[model samples]
Target: MSKPVILCVDDERIVLDSLRTQLAAAFGDAYIYEGAEDAEEALDLINDLNEEGISVILIISDWLMPGIRGDELLIQIHKNYPNVIKILLTGQADEVAIDRAQKQANLHRCLSKPWSEAHLLETIKSGLSKL
Candidate 1:
C-alpha cells in the first residue's frame, strides 16, 4: 500500500519546521508533510500532488492565517476531497468558529497551540488509524 500523505498548514515557519522534524521522526517515509504559510499555497500543492497521483489522506491546519481561514479552506477541501480527515491546530476556538468547522469542514479535532509533542503524535496516530 502507498504511504499516507499528511498536509500540515501553519503560518509560522518555526512551527512548520518543528512539526516536519517531529513527524518525520515518528512516521518516517510513510507520511508526507507539506507545511504552507497560507491556505492558497497549500491548495496549490494539493493540486500538484493530485496530478502526481498522490492522495493526501489527512490535513492539519491552523484556524487563523493571513489569507483564507482554516475553516474556509477545509470547507473547500471537504467539498472536493470528502474522504480526507481534517484536523485543526489553532489558538482561537470560539463557539461560532467551532460550529462552522463542524458544519463545513467536519473537523475531526482541534488541538490548541503549545501542544505537547506526545499528544500531537498520539492524535495524529489516531487520525491516521481511522483511514
Candidate 2:
C-alpha cells in the first residue's frame, strides 16, 4: 500500500518549494509530500490519490489564491474526506473565513503566512497524533 500523503497547495512556487523541503526534512520518507499550485489541480490530485487508495492524511493550503480560496478548498475536502487534517496558512485571511473553516472544514490550525518551521512541524505532529 502507498504511504499517506501530505499535500500542500500554494500559488507561489517558492512557498511550495519551502514546504516540500521542510516536510521532507521533518517527516523523511515516511509519507508522500505533494504540491499543487492551485485548488483545482489539488482537487484533481486528491481525487486521483483517493481512487488509487492512497490516503491523504493532511493538507496545508494558502488562503488567497486565484481560483478557490483556501477555506473553500478545505471545506470541499472535508465534505468528502473528513478524516484528512486541514491547516490554513495565510497572510491575510480574515476572522470570518477562519471561523468558517473551523466549523465546516474541521480545520486543525491556522498559521500566519510567515510561519516558523518549528511551529509548522509541531502542528503537523499534533495533527498526526490525533490520527
Best candidate (score: lDDT): 2
Candidate 1, pairs of clashing residues? none
Model 1 poorest 10 in a row by lDDT: 1-10
The residue-by-residue lDDT of candidate 2 on 77-124, one tens digit each, is 999999999999999899999999999999999999899999999999
- Look at candidate 2 and give me any clashing residue pairs: none
Off by over 4 Å in 2: none
- Estimate candidate 1's alpha-carbon lDDT, on a 0 to 1 scale: 0.86
Assess the local accuracy of residue 128 in candidate 2 as a C-alpha lDDT between 0 and 100.
Answer: 92
Please, what are the lDDT tens digits per residue for candidate 1 over residues 32-122? 7888889999899888888888899998898898979988899999888888899888898676887898898888888899888899889
Tell me the TM-score of model 2. 0.99
**RMSD after Cα superposition, model 2:** 0.5
